[model samples]
Target chain A: MKLLESGVVSENRKHIISFIILAATLLLVFPLVFDIFRLNLVAKYLSLAFAAVGLVICWGHGGILSLGQGVFWGLGGYCLAAFLKLEAAVNIANEAGTDQIKALTTVGLPDFMDWNQITELPYIWYPFKSFPITLICVLIVPGIVAFIIGLAIFKRRVSGVYFAIITQALCWIMEILFVTRQGWTGGINGITDLRTCLGWDIRTQAAQYTLYFLTAGLLLAVILFSKKILSSKLGQLLVAIRDMEDRVRFSGYDVSNFKIFSFCLAAMISAVGGALFVLNVGFMSPKLVTIAPSIYMVIFCALGGRESLIGVVYGTLIVCFGRTYFSEQFPELWMFLMGGIFIVVTVACPKGLAGLFESHGAKALAFLKKFLKIENLASKDKKEVEA
Target chain B: MSSTDYALYIENLTVSFDGFKAVDDVSIYVEKGTVHVVIGPNGAGKTTLLDLVCGKTKPTAGKIKFDDYDLTTMHEQDIVQAGVGRKFQTPSIYPSLTVFENLEVSYPKGRGVWGALGFKRDQEVIDRIHEVADMIYLSDKLQTPGELLSHGQKQWLEIGMLLIADLQMILLDEPVAGMSVVERKQTADLLRKISQNRSILVIEHDMNFVREIAHRVNVMHQGKVIAEGSMETVEKNEKVIEVYLGH
Candidate 1:
């Protein structure tokens, strides 16, 4: 309580403002920042950033290390894709002047979809036809899923590695569900050939940029929102819960409610990011939502500096950029290099690349001196390299 | 306090872990604005009893009342909101949070999911935090990270946090377990000041520290109150002597 009165908030505000300034400037130049191919790639990176921000809240701030944020991301993507596929079918039927109600959209209803006897579009598919509700549903579907999952896990007082495992299971389960439910989801193939999203010609660069800028804006908003929480009482409480939840509960703060709230918020953020991602990419599949990519998100957070939002984005951009730029150039060696980088980070620069540039890094270095004298001796050489 | 003003009441409340009753059918009353110390030998359930009262542990049986609420049915957080704050034997401050942010977490209701996500300090709460910080002698270290503080300072920060929450009753588990001599003295004085307006249930091992501040002491052995009275009276009780002071 006494802590906030002094100067923490002001310092945090400066960091946030500068970050906004940096993000705004970048958004303005996104068209020219990279070529169209790379820009599309950046769009994917933006989605990854969105998902990582949720991780920061759940794992970094609240101490629930969810290795499965990809579940929420995948859910959002699938919900949006589902509507688009239905809308495409309806549009094709309408264009063909065949409201016969019984005309099949595709072969054998894909798999789970009932094709033969269905003449009219299901009422459930009606709301999705309207862009506004579809938009709302995009956010709601994942939000509801995260809420229910968080309610169950947090209520029982689950924490630490156990919480991480459950979230992983959640992602794995979702991927399996999506893959198995081929009729509804298009299964392993996923719904594709989407030319329009929300009545906009997604093929147009303006539309692409509109979605891109929106993604950037959302990421900024989330960063600011998280910054506020992280600076205030909730942030402190969250950190306390992470360090020692029993102490916080005894302190009368209701650790469970806070955990659930943070978890759900993280999920919602991942959902938003996921929806934006599919809209930009024009496709999504079970492959994108699988455990490998989910764990890759965790690795990005680790590489970026788990505690810093800026770091997460930075990590995503760097790694995603590498996977894109280096894969074609050195396909044989790309994965090996990525794995090596993670090893180097985990074993060597564990403060993450971001810490190297932070002010407290010197103090952190000092703290490390207590255990690692060799690092102390090598600082001058590293500084020369950095310089 | 008068009979009507009793701060907390417990009746045969018991808790068991793996078939062992850690807190066995215990009932006690704490007077308002008094410093009541619970003293017991190690593993005598001193902590488990505090946990039960604070809603950190659910009892296996019985009834406990706080202010006007049923303790057994209450959530840990609502119990906190019901005007009870707790301080653990260990310093529970977030090492990464500054002393001020640590204090802010003690605010009762700012945790609105939306509000909490973008919160700033209210001027009044900030002023109250300053007052408590000065009282606890933590004003100078307001910006210091909790992990950087000495053990004594960390203890003060935790107590300082509970004070800001302004609970009607505070459950302190061994508040002086690891304090240095000077810090211990400061804590004793701080407790005296806090208890002037609120009931304090302090669990402690150091008899001298207990005698310094406790208006009354409750002794426990094997999960039941053996004797209850002032330090001097409990010190002379035959059962208390056999369980704690003797041998």
Candidate 2:
């Protein structure tokens, strides 16, 4: 414990300490200081932070600035929303085949219910008839998609700015495809009218609180999980693959496998966050998959300090909470304000908000070490004289 | 297997990139436990030979047979598993990982994505890590980040990482390129100690470094091995003198 403290905590405990304090403060009663609507808004922003931390791993450490994580987030959200939407349609149906017929009609079923030949929904859609399927698809759908994507991209050695451009292209292309294709993905309107998640009635205040707390719990788990990954042997390979790939190859490692691991993990984390996001908001749409939202995800990660977990959360909260204050008054100024911060961070700080906080004391430590060296030299000289 | 039965046998090996032959029609063989150094002036394709052996680049044509197995078609990682460890011109240890962790990373099955996450190093593996670290005189820096080390220390750590793989053959590409004289001497000594029981091939631009480490030197020019013999014999060869040793 002492060794760990001297190595890690002694340098700076402020970020971790401040995070605990803020979490405690929120647990105390933002519920009392603010209304349920406001609390839900706070919950939503934190959920975004969970996803951004996932970005930090791939973009910051792995040297892959992924812009298509929004796709995973969208997948998770829609999978859950689809299952939930499917469940809604099933329960609200009066006749056996009519609801099924109406859904097909909604997709181009034909003139009348009599024309419908199929009595049952697709086999794959059957499990979604239950609430559990809705809940699990939130993670499983994105997990599968990310696994496939990671396999293809990493196998091809797509990395650096080229990888970033490809991922960003993926984000915009997916958004366009989703917007245009009304048959499969429901067009720009997206999957809406989600009344509940699992068995929880989302319309009630109790359910809202349940989701609010779930978001908080999920964020904490992801923060700890990301920290563990970044500190592990897997993390060492990821960074090695980033900084000196050719060298890593000579050292007998399969660099592609490590890249795939990081990509897949990042995808799963974002997927979970996205699912939690839709639960609190009761919506999923093509608007969520656009380049703008992907860019916003990057903005929050940059603001938070790409290297620091807590910084990402703080940056997410600041941008999201601050938006409400600016949306009504100087809506035009909001983007510019963020743009200016990005420029300053990229040019001056380069480490983001956490870097800004820790650098103050980091400089002092560097000075102290220098002073200690001189002291040690003087002591050695005195010992020689005594000898 | 007999020495004549092939530790390494390359036949009609040819490699090119964008129509330029990096390695063209190169073939060589090594007996087990032999220390062979490849030497040449700049652009002689010595590094390319090592790259081909280590599977860093694929050949356009030919066979690289190690023992009974053909190595020309193998993946870089599989070639590594087939007992070929490469140390590059620059130190390539993980700058973020401690020396022990860096060594642990290359410890055979301690790699791979799934295995790396769930498998903790066994005591035997950990002890081997210590042994390698001690051999490289990096015991003090076991807990220190590779980035925090001096240039010589990084070199030693890279070697230590390779040593933990316990391969039958090692390929070192310009291993003493960026080291101090004292560090160079130590690396020569370390290579001598390891080469007693393993087949070792090294690429060197320096005749002096090759002399210090080579049991026999093979001088390469234009992607082909031109002359092979004892250091003194190769240095005195007319072809080698006219092409590589002109300076």
Candidate 3:
């Protein structure tokens, strides 16, 4: 009892400390350090952190690697973007003169639909018409999609590189669907010109600030919730499954159900990130839903330490910042530079930043302790001579 | 023997890998509360028979009845849940988890995803862990990670995991293959202790260990059981001596 209690207390303390540092950095530090434009960009990157965090749970802990996280993110972004686009259309129609409205061809349809000769809103777009339904779809749509995908794949016992390839293929399919279906989807351009959400001018600096905090807040909540799971028996079982799948199966666990749960949870979390990405950026695009971004999200988790939730957050921030800075400074060389960094980080620190910290951080602490002991000895000698 | 008197009844069990029958037409009955050991030369299909009974591998033609459940048609986990536990040849404990956690994870409760998430480390779980840990002689090493354990301890830890699940029958694949002499003795004692109220089916090569624990012995040669009796009686059998014991 004593051993268990002490273990729980220490574990809780470590989690508490990490949570405080992350919460302060996201909620306090970033807001104070960066201007609104940069802060908005941080919010965008933090939105992707949701996907990284999900990867930590699914790929890192559960040992199920998914390369199509962007699909769920895109689904979420498109869900909210659809709603906002409709609202923007209504706003445009209300503010337009009779001649301008007639020129639009459809009074309250998104401009892309009007341009594509889509006379009426499609049935799929009907759910996005209501904010409450859109909110539910943002979570459920991606959740159900993930659930179905997980059930099909995991139940069949398809895993490892095969699962990763299947998810990558899913991203490719989504990208094509979003690109070719111009009337229903925004087609390559995506659902842009998303000016308002529930009559609130989300484009305003004040709204941007609010969205940034909201994103940070939600991301922190997700981290905490994931921590709860990791500390639970379910988390231990995932680790056990990863180690010896046969043993866990023989231990009477269905195994696939846990895998499905992790995958669905990851998809839902990624979808939430997607919704925030739409709100913060004021647009949702097929570009963000493609293979490259999905792979990049995986790299974010990998580079941060796939196993470390807070480390992935830092990993996302660093990579996103590096991308923005490099792209601005050396547009031609940034891709290579980013690639080089990823290779170096992964090769040098295979456990990612968290592993680096664990190994070197302990050594550094030991050195600090030794240095402090020497200082204390010197102070004691001086005090004795004075006495 | 009447089927009701036996804890495990495997009949006409045959498994083939591309026309190569690993376990062919084997029938064995393990009486309740008894230790049944299958001893054989290498490639004699002793392990395959255990795999068939535990649902790790489906038999090409056979029926394995564990109490009232049809083990042949059940999933590996379902077989386990139906009070059958299997230990692999190697120590297959979770290396990252502590010994206590290894045992705790195998405890019968919270097998589902949500149940696991909400599973509390309650007094009952803790008490059971301690109880099993002591039984396996790993009480002091409960907090140690499984990887840190010596080879013998890892095997015992795996056994403890099976025991904590309150299984009625255990399928052991060479429980003491890599143990030191002392560990082998302790394991012999541990097996005898655990088999008090339950049935144990073991695949073993160590004759002395088998002699120490097996209530009944079956000697197999080329996917067929050649002899069945006590160690002394099996040693006296002509076919067992010619094929396996080789004077």
Candidate 4:
């Protein structure tokens, strides 16, 4: 009994160590391997990977596939963009004298709003002027939206493909609303020319590097927190609810509350990713918050092995990088090729890289162990540290 | 007993789908610490009766009260929280999780989202898990995934899950439907053992198994109880024999 218990504990330790090593590599390795431009792109991809991580738990583990993650991501992105836009507006007014200020704006509106012939800053945009409020909105807006949606849908027992379709429609609705509401959002042009965040001049290469590290650090922390939730009793209930929802209910669990909580948490995580994304990418557009990107987010979770957090990170990086590479090289054929990959991956490996690793990863690791002639990686490191 | 001698009180319950009555104005009472088996032919609305009581199906009229709680207005989870546990016709366990986890999830503590996040499998939980595991003969398969268990073992695991919650009443639908002869006998024994502490409402087709475990038997026909008595008395009931046995 004692030996059996210790074996289980050791296996958990191995997984934890592997996760830490992977996170450390992600955090430190890219800066050494790539220049600022490439690292900035990586940071951008990691930000999307945040939404993918949420998908891993909410859709993969909980069996609630949300095809509208872009709504939350967009919400978060726009919140930050609005804040930066407000900062730029204030800066513009300050630089220009009071005489020029009256000439520059009807009531100190954003340049885009002025260009679109809007005189006054909207009431909603007033709150974004405060950085603290913007930060809070970035997290709270998406969370509250998700909570209400989850409450309405889950309480009525709407789930599976129906839930996915409803969320997909929600993405399209939000996208259209953002595009058509020109004064509120920047419409087709989006909130652009975001030059500074709190007078820090974010366009500089040094700022880019700092943002890259910060995004990496934040992603790593979210992954660890997600990992903790996945290992808890709540995680087991999620699987149980996924397999047999009625059974979980029969066992005295408020199934809808669990669903709501997970959806809300996923939304908040995606919002954080979105805010960081705006910081790295320097823009927030309605185009990024549509059904297509939302579906792409689902595919990111799928290709990464919907079940594996690290697999999701790699999935997002590989797919995003591949898209950029292919689009630049082939342009027209990239879409065809990407579509083919999605179809093949879905058909061939439904569980994604995680499932593949589960079946073959151990064999590959063992083969490497024998070929390298370096005793067990885990114990060897332990022995070295002991010595 | 108190004012209510029954653990489960059903008064003129009726459920209709479209215009057809699935469970018509039927009333049944299950005394505390007793096994009350409902035996009927197919489409006799036996399962629907159990469903209405467990809040899986809402009745068109009448009331279901579990002890002091009016269960007709409660949701399935709330009914369970009110100390009613239900097992479906099929073995509904999380196939990917271990047998221990299958039971651990139903331990009735730390059930909410935040509570479950910090729930640790302390010695008390572990001990209860082991006790239930031994009772269900799943102790050896504690670490084994539920999918690996045989159908009978899976059924036992589901029952063990309900037991871990410390329920006041248990509802079983076709508990021995696919069990082997030996497995059926063991299930009967298990049901008998569990009924010593709480009320059990079983919907069974196998008259022999019902005969083994029933303290009182209610024979139903076409959505209404045709006979209600001890097994010996119900077997001799001409209406029950004709509708069910057809002799």
Number of the top candidate by TM-score?
Answer: 3
Model 4 residue runs over 4 Å out of place are: A1-4, A7-11, A106-108, A375-387, B1-3
Question: How would the docking of model 4 be graded?
Answer: medium
Q: DockQ order of candidates, best first?
A: 3, 4, 2, 1
Give one digit per residue, the lDDT tens place, for model 1 in A56-149: 8778778888888888888788778767776666565566665453354542122236532344444555666667787788788878887888
Q: In DockQ terms, which candidate is top? A: 3
Best by lDDT: 3
Off by over 4 Å in 2: A1-22, A29-33, A90-124, A361-387, B1-6, B17-20
Ranking by TM-score: 3, 4, 1, 2
TM-score list, all predictions: 0.87, 0.87, 0.96, 0.95
Compared with the true structure, what per-residue lDDT tens digits does model 2 show for residues A1-387? 233234554334444666686577556566668788999998888767767888878877776778888888887777777676765555445334665656654332212111334343545555566667666777677777777877888788878788878888888888888777554556788877777655567868898887888888778778877877776667767777777787677666788878777777777788887788778888789889768778788888887788777788888887787777676667889767766767887788778887787767445644565677876755654443233
Candidate 3 runs further than 4 Å off: A366-387
True lDDT of residue B91, candidate 2: 73
Local error of candidate 3 at residue B108 (angstroms) = 0.7
Better of 1 and 4 by DockQ: 4
Worst 10 residues of 3 chain A by lDDT: A378-387
lDDT of 3 by residue, B99-180 (tens): 9889989999999998999999988888999999999999988878999999999999998999999999999999999999
